[model samples]
Target: MGIVVIKLGGSLIQGLSNTFFEHINLLQRNGKKVIIVHGGGPLINNLLLKFSIPVEMEDGLRKTSNEVLEVVEYALNGKTNKDLVIMCNQFNLSAIGLSGCDNLLLEASLYDKGKLGWVGEVENVNTSLLELLLTNDYLPVISPIGVDKIGQKYNINADLAAKSIAKALNAEVLCYVTNTNGVLNSEGKSIEKITKDQVQALIESKTITDGMIPKVQSALDALDEVQSVAIVGENFLNEDGSMNGTVFTKGVVFSE
Candidate 1:
């Protein structure tokens, strides 16, 4: 097994069961190198409100000003990363928490200054540090704040960050550990497989609507660099080592 980049959504973190960690351990035991990237959106929002900072979003990206950037870092790095690292450690998994700025893991540029201030687009990912940690049997828990060449750190989106890292590492899968049970069809059941083109068509037909649009779009944007992407809920693993999720693969026939 090779590298598998898993992106844990902030909203779903609290509900993650012990079985999830067991699944991770099973993957590690079977020779799959795991890299975890996590988000803390809800925590960030709470802090923003506490500080009286106005929260805003532009196309699913947070609008980060200088003040808000501090709070973002506090929530993601100081709080979420710390808690996740501890969780992994409690499960006997050797883990270390790091930010995108650490060893220049993620190099980014300002996405849109006018619309989404201080938000970043992942210009590139340097996988050397990640490889080093994985080789040493350490799971790297990453927080998605990126740094620029001029030492400017911008708040980045966790989903895109995981995708970029997957590309750089040539990971087998970019697994989004989301709140939903994959993408749902019109019947409200999880579609086992889909193509990015099909996802776009579903969006056009309104079969995939509202919040699901950005999730699928993010997966689509990453397809050029990644071989496949998966969307799964927290309880994805069964006792039998099987998984339930929707996998998006290019140029492949769709099936259950």
Candidate 2:
């Protein structure tokens, strides 16, 4: 079985329906090994507000300060990760929740201590445990938090973390399950498929902007490492296995 890494954003967690888990089950039933890396933005922000800490975002990524990093960990690891794991168990998926800081699974240094504060760019992914868990048929739900050599923890962008892990595991595809349908064209319609060249063209044309731009660009970068990448809405995957999303490939794009 091949690996499939999913980057599930916190923003979409509340809206995830039973149908979504069914689709995940469908993937597993078809012999696809699934791993999940998730974010907890809304939850983090809420906690930050509850504690009177100002929330900051830079270039679609969170600007995590030491103070905010604590809250981020609480949201991602303590709350969101456990929630997803329980949800998977409820569906008989049998999930194990983990953090990049667990057993040095992911090692990293600060991305830019000055710019993004405690944000991290994954320097290395330790795939041994991951492979072991996958071999045992357990889905790993990962919290995107990395630790440095000196035992300093940094918040990692879930998408980038998922991409690095996917590349390390040689996953068949890395999928971003977001709230939107997919990358849209100028007319606000989901583009069926896209190549790297077309992604650049779309970026230059300003058709992809705001949060969606960063997501597609992240997927574009991940495409170089993974066989294929996709950005789709939570419901984009149908019971029939047809999908509504923009797929990015290295060369010419084609429907499966």
Candidate 3:
């Protein structure tokens, strides 16, 4: 069965449409194994505010201090992960919630010499565990919180974490589920397809800005390993199996 990795943006978690879950069901019916990596930025920020802890970010990545890491873990693993699992189960998808730290699902190393304090980049992914779950027909919903060899936990950017997992699994498709339908042009229209080469140009032209930069960049990065990458919203996959989103390809126009 082909594997698909979906990266769900935290902003869209609370409002994901039924159509989104239905599309997941459709993928399963088509014999695809699905895995999900999710972010909890909004929830984390809320908890941080509730605790009066200053929320900090650098280059679109949350700057995680020791105290901030605790909140991040609680919001991501404790709340967001379970919420997504429940949503999946409600849609008749057998979803298993997990943290990147669980069973060493995602091993990591400190990023930028700990400049982003407690933030890390994925060094490895436990594909064996994933395969075992997928083999049993269970969808794994992963929270992007990683741990190092010495038991030190680190916060991982969900988009980058998904890219790492997709690369490790050599997934057939890597989809970033965002609030927007897809990458939008300056005219505010969704571009149906974008080549890897076009990504940098779009960024340069300021068409893709702010939060979308990382999502688009991560999609571009995953294109080297995954056959296809897309940035899409809830109404992404169609009944006919075609996708509606900004598809990233390696110089070839997307056909289906």
Candidate 4:
């Protein structure tokens, strides 16, 4: 069985359906070891609002100050992580919640020279810890909160975190679970498959904008190590267990 890394976007978590969990179950039954890396943007924003902290973001990444880091940790590690773990268990999939700081699951260094305060980019992934859990048939639900060698914690972008883990593990597939169906064209229809060059063209045309920019970039970055990558919605799996989404590839011919 090969490994699959699924990045669940923060915005999709609360709305995830029973079918989504069932799809994950099917993947396991089909002998695909699964690892989930999740985001908590909305929840973190809510917590920040509750504390009257100013919400800030640079590009698609959150600008995490020390105060913001505390709320991020609470929302991501404390709430979102456990919720996903419980959902997996309810669906009969054994899952364990984890923070990147736990056992240094994700070791990181500052991103952009600390321009974004506590924001970080992954420097290492604890593959041994992940493999141990996966070997025992336990799905790992990880939060994108990384720690440094000096015991300092930082907020990592979930998409990038998933990419790093997938690369480290040489995963067979990496799926980004987003709110939209997939990458949309000017007509707002899902494009079945896209290549790297085409992706840049779309970006230039402004068809792919904002947060999608980061997600697609992460997919391309993961392509160096992963065999397959897709940006999919909650109902990504079809009746035949095939994926239904915008598949990202290296130099394949495009097909809608």
Candidate 5:
């Protein structure tokens, strides 16, 4: 009766297929309270290009500046957030779009003081507002953006944002929705499942490097607090609209 928190990546939200919405509808039918945390890299990048703003990345982490933060908030909160809400409302689901900035729900610290600019890492999550939304059966669609105590707005990584919320809410499940089918090896084969120890091994070997490295690490971290953390394929939508992405847990594996 708790809840499920899904960290839907910006890459997926760039254009989620109808199949995804169907899966969400199914989850709602089953009386599951799902909160969606989203990112908007694609949209933000497009805007940056149009404005002739130079974009930069190191280790897949975007370099945030005041210029980039403006575009990020516009895309993530304005476009991406509302689009997901509209999609759910089409299925008669009550979806309320919001950003982490609302009510200071998410407090953050600059990811890198001298280099990362306004790219902030979550420091604390205020669950009171979210809990109120869920108690009323409203699916809270969230954009990962927050402001610091000094009123400096920061763009948060969606994966970490969702993890924080899930832990705060003591959610039963945390699913990370990405474009890929799931965790893949160097051979580009989907790894149905593996133990946390195995995941660490892959990380050590650099098999799971780059952006994916943080994702897997976050999943493992969530395991200690949440019931389960899954990295699933976006295509795994249920017939009734529930999510069907591949799930990862303690030693959970599926046959390819």
Candidate 6:
């Protein structure tokens, strides 16, 4: 079977929700190959503030300096990645945590250094290492950090990293475990299903503003390759066991 690349948000990882681990176990038991790409932005930010590294943000993404990137790598790969591995183990799910630089799994180029310093855009995603782990029934937990050919480290956006890995592995599902209750309307209710065209309108009207813009954009980018991209409401999951999420697909129309 192919993989299901799940991009677990930084917030989700921090909360240490048992429900998240339960869902992952279910996926594993169902014979689904799962790979987790996680972010540690909040953790990194907190640590940076503690160290007084002077962090900044623009359009929901952290504008990382070299000092900031160092803290990001340490917190993400060293701390958070290992923590997630431990959590998965407690759930009886064997996990091997890694970063993109481990085996050159994800090659990337700098993404607009003028604005976002040391942030990388994934140029290539080789999934052989991930496949091997999955084939052996081990869940591969990944930190969003890539490297160049000469071994220069770069911080890849979790959303983009997940999408790239999903597309590369031809994953059956790409799920974005997000903070909100799915995509909200002007009235602030969760919209269950949204198409590419509708997304454009939402952006234009500012209904899907802020950090949600990248979530939607990543979903749209993955739709061309993956089976489907699910913008799931993590909050809704806490309220009801059922997945209250918006499904993004290629042929989805407004009528659905």
TM-scores for all candidates? 0.91, 0.92, 0.94, 0.95, 0.89, 0.91
Which candidate do you rate higher for lDDT, 5 or 6? 6
- 1-256 per-residue lDDT for model 4 (tens digits): 5999999989989878999898889899999999999998889989899999998886688898889999999999898999889888999889999989989999999999999999999999999999999999999999999999899999999999999999999999999999888999999999899989889999999999877887999999999899999999999887986668999878855589
Query: lDDT for each of the candidates?
Result: 0.84, 0.86, 0.90, 0.92, 0.81, 0.83
For model 3, the stretches where C-alpha displacement exceeds 4 angstroms are: 252-256
Candidate number of the best TM-score? 4
Sort by TM-score, best first.
4, 3, 2, 6, 1, 5
C-alpha lDDT (0 to 100) for residue 24 of candidate 2: 82
lDDT of 6 by residue, 1-256 (tens): 8578888888777676777788877778778899999887778878998998887776556777888889999999999999989988999889899899988988988988637988888989877888888999999999989999998888888888999999999898898887776788899888888888889999999888766877788889998889867888554243343456888857634673
- In terms of TM-score, which candidate is stronger, 3 or 6? 3
Clash counts per candidate, in order, are 0, 0, 0, 0, 5, 0
Which residue pairs collide in model 6, if any?
none
In candidate 6, what residue range of length 10 has the lowest lDDT sum? 233-242
All models, RMSD in angstroms: 2.9, 3.0, 2.8, 2.5, 3.8, 2.9
Supply the TM-score for candidate 6.
0.91
Rank list by lDDT: 4, 3, 2, 1, 6, 5
**Model 3 C-alpha lDDT per residue in residues 1-256, reported as the tens digit of each score:** 5999999999989988898898899899989999999998889999999999998886578888999999999999999999999999999999999999989999999999999899999999999999999999999999999998889999999999999999999999999988888999889999998986777888888887777877888888888789988888878786677777888877856678
* Candidate of highest lDDT: 4
Q: What lDDT score is found at residue 226 in candidate 5?
A: 94
Off by over 4 Å in 5: 237-246, 251-256
* Model 6 collision count: 0
